[model samples]
Target: MYQLIALDLKAARKEKTTKQKESLAKIALLHQNVQSLGNSINEINQMLMDHDDCKFICITEHWKSQDQIINYGIRNFKLASCFCRKEGKHGGSAVFVSLAVQCLERSDIRSLSVVGSFECAAVKCSLNGMNFIILSIYRTPSGNMHVFLEKMEQILSKISDDSASVFIAGDFNIDFSQDSPNKQLSCSLLNSYNIQQTIFQFTRITSASESCIDNIFTNISPFVSNVINSSISDHTAQKITVMVDMNKPANAVKKRILNNERFLCRLKSVDWQNVFHIPQNDVNEQWNYFSNIFQSIFEQVFPMKTFKVTNRFTDSHHPEKIKNNIKECKDRLDVLYVISNSDNSYKPCYNKEKSTINY
Candidate 1:
């Protein structure tokens, strides 16, 4: 669940209301280090309060010290660190999750220190039972720009596998177009990992330069549904709506069936009861037994097909467009066997056999 606000939030600063419910997850990547943050934190907190139901929050290039973070908890959100509290103008990366959601797991809450690199953190969490990985990235000043980008690509590719969904968002420092030094490297990594890239326009910063440095990319799992421009910061925040399935029952069945490693391990672990246990069964026999078990499990879990929008974008204007986009994203997820809902999470609709209407 990633949504970007590509503007300086300081201008429209307002407090959160008691009755407002959060309907989206927000992620902000800012270049303003702690020293220059001004009143942005307050502005951001106010915005978060508005969308109180949105659980997760991630911010890159956070220049604040750990003491400051510990003393004040970013209004209502809990903060996680990925960098040490160094003195005097030193800034790195940090993450924030809402107080309403359960704390699951997080990556090395330490800064990814490279010679020219800024701050970074890799976080792992399950939103409404859907798992996703987020990386806060920063670039350096020295070395072959291409080589630096290549290293970054290597890191992303190494972490992303066929099993989990991955999202990397932060200040890239360099653009992704052909003229940019790391364009090829950026394109190669994104193409290989199937990540989404977006640029937002900010008029307040860079005088009037329309720079597109900040980016958001994803691999597998919840698909990117949209990207929105912001009026909060000098840089445009990306609003990415990730499509996640809500049918938990069917998802459980699919997880057991599709997880080849786990499934094989389970098969090896199963012991025969006192009567008529077959040994070293052929592939077909094993498959038959597996299918029967799966069928029974599915019948118990998913008795009917249900459509629930688990993840979505609040700023998105078109409902039909968003629905269609979500369907497409689900199709991609089905191919990877990563959709969360066991029944509606799979392809061609889970009730094909009992479907009353013809295609």
Candidate 2:
């Protein structure tokens, strides 16, 4: 049974390639510097369509306003958390989590974010009986490196947990492919926290330049990652896979006392004659007596009920379920994105998808 969460972004059916689709461990992630999420929403959707198992989406340079991001999001996945520029028209970050996972936004870490130096959005994810923090970060090429390093340390210090892992993904604009003062200091800072840069392949490829500025940093063990050529920008994307124990109750377990018509009827059915005929003549004392009686009946009428909460949708492997949810997901997409960036509203941020080929 393949459980699902996150956006409803799907693509037309295609023949499966040699890509690894099934895994003994189920947690998978996809990271990209989309240039502009509004324009690249379709591409991002299509990418998730091909790699349907990817539950986490980390994006930098979303280039959308906080207002716009608040109004729109992908269908199946929850737009877990986001940070957009206040003054500038570009440079922002977002973290999307699967519906099957539970995460808490780390605003304490996010409050430390600054525009030019360090911009980030982080979430503490609790999945499959494990806890970890996923941070999506971005820094400008000309941004202040000193401030970036300082804020990064504070952010790391605040979120550091002995029991939880930390995963950082971003376009830091510092080329790890070449030796430079910026690269050295950044690597040293991350190394201090035992977080190592994971992607080694050149992420950006142009006829004139090739660089590895886009990367993922982590201290997680038993994990594997690869560079994927996304035609979204000069910057390529990345995918990370980790096997985690799935037997534990992971998603979310919630319990509630059902307050239904039966409860209401039972409450009214109670013998309230005693409350009215109480020995106390004082009005306050009589009300208190009624309250106690009401409380006693309330507890009896409503009993605690527990259930495991899971996302309504499931992964593509469950073809029948996925197909049925497609229409329902699209309906939600329409309401969230009333402007409708789904098909025809996109303007190419860098290269048009039709002109560029992605794997």
Candidate 3:
């Protein structure tokens, strides 16, 4: 599923003309429901590698605790802000911004409203000279829609007075496909603040139907807005592109990659028996001796070499044959689903094929 999305992004980039590429500085915003980011970290990394311009990624349903937040960090990006459910282990929200972008959590706004049955994380940042307040939220399936909207009204009311552009994207759990009262009220409330939803297509896909529950709303007009067809999760990823000034100077940083094989070999070669041998008279002397030996080994084994970072997207290491196999699995599942609808004998076959896809 992730490989398919990466391939599509690569193909899209290749199809772009030189003129279109050089027109303006564009930042892409991506939102997804990574059932558990810890389990889908590789897929998220592949998506980021494929779309380097993605400056902000809003993730819902992270299913992580406060102490486990560090485990979901993405390379080259900073975890700007996150909100985890206090009572349960299921619902959570997070926003990751590129290291090049200046971003900070908006605790003042977050403090103004209490998240009763929903999770939300917001960040204020400047990207390519444009200031924005981006929010990532996840509303539970059984959460009260009216209560959530009331809190949203307060947040938007406060932010509407500011000049910085506002973007609120998330899985609100309101099915836009049906003419439900909650959907109508949500749309009307957004309209009152002159905020337009950028995502028009359905985000969640299934064998039987689809829905537009995931959305991106912003006050400023974006350069482009579309949904990326992916099976990384039940919901497809929504991407929004906005143009910014390209004349701003860039801040580039260098990072080091340690040689783990050499480090491990050096550690294994250490004579632990001799290192542990110490004078029984003074405990401080024994501690100092061990510390010195450890420091010396670390310095010799793990020397750092700096490499300057660039705006180049790396290709995925996943093989083409494996991607073809995944595609074939999806095709087989679709065929089985269609057949099962008409013939009762195909129901078991559909279930077997579905289990193989691991969607």
Candidate 4:
């Protein structure tokens, strides 16, 4: 099912003419459960088309059968979905993308074999030769959150190595509240991989007087930009926008290395090995140390001046620098694990054959 849909702004910007800057556009995540009355799909489409800035609209939980989907034929958008015979409705999740941006690869809608659930799929696109992967997730209601997350963790581990920029959004059906950590159940594992979790409460936000459910999480750092509490759906939809800049001078690389060193030094110096074994509770102490390190690296490496490209939005396959950064981050994680006596599960960091250690 299409839990989430994303458009590559960097790709869309290329097609814009000089006079079309005002129409640069915005991406919106409009969450809705169409099964309920008074929230027709046609109304949703009409409301979305009214937005001048809205380019891509990601819809979640369209609880309609296959027959309704084919017969209704909503206009000016491409829809993708995964359905199951639950509650006599063809419901799970679905995504809607504006017809303007071209879909580079076919949609992946199937039962993710790892878990025996008919939920989750991905769509791929190439913007300036950089690949982007957007995945949709829906955990089974009967299954424990841990079991679902474990399966999800295994499935994602295989794809993390891909160079494509990844964005995962959906109806996780799990609450991420710290008050009752048990509510976390199987979904807690996502917190381990730098995935930022934000709640989008549909049930409460629509009718009740509360706000805490539904979510969007991603490992892509700095979170780009987002709009929460938008009123497109009964479920509060969040719109996230990201900008990737790659341009730098040769001297900047050396300076960035120096910056990363300073970041490392700011933390209390400990033998790297001892630091790794810190219990989950104490991981924060270690994270404060390493997060600074990553921020330092990201700050230096992410600026467009780091690479020679003038317009990152137009250049093709220009992520050679970002690829190197991903590699460096992976290496740093490995070194931390080895030094800290932690087992190398190889899930949080991507493992590569050529990623040799340099002691």
Task: Identify the candidate with maximal TM-score.
Answer: 2
What is the descending lDDT order?
3, 2, 4, 1
Q: Higher-TM-score candidate among 2 and 4?
A: 2
Two-way lDDT contest, 1 vs 2, winner: 2
Which structure among the candidates has the greatest lDDT?
Answer: 3
lDDT of 3 by residue, 1-359 (tens): 99999999988887775546675687789999888888888888887787898989999888888789877778889999888766767788889999999987877555533343457888888765666788998887788764576567656655543445678889888887765656755775575456778888899988998899999988666558988865678998898888764553333322223344454455446564553366566645554554455446545643334333343211222345435433443433243233314335446555655675565
Relative to the true structure, candidate 2 reaches a TM of 0.61
- Evaluate model 3: give its TM-score: 0.61
Once fitted onto the true fold, the runs of candidate 4 whose alpha carbons sit more than 4 angstroms away are 1-30, 36-39, 50-55, 73-75, 104-109, 113-118, 140-143, 182-188, 199-203, 206-211, 224-234, 246-359
Q: What does each candidate score in C-alpha RMSD?
A: 20.0, 24.0, 25.5, 12.7
Model 3 lDDT, residue 325, Cα: 36
- What's the lDDT for all of these models? 0.45, 0.67, 0.69, 0.45
lDDT by residue (tens digit), candidate 2, 260-310? 345435544656455547564664555555545544554564433434545
Off by over 4 Å in 2: 1-24, 246-359
lDDT of 1 by residue, 279-303 (tens): 4445345434543454344334323
- Write down the TM-score of every candidate: 0.52, 0.61, 0.61, 0.52
Tens-digit per-residue lDDT, 39-94, candidate 4: 56566656656553443444445555545554444467676444433455434555
TM-score of 1: 0.52
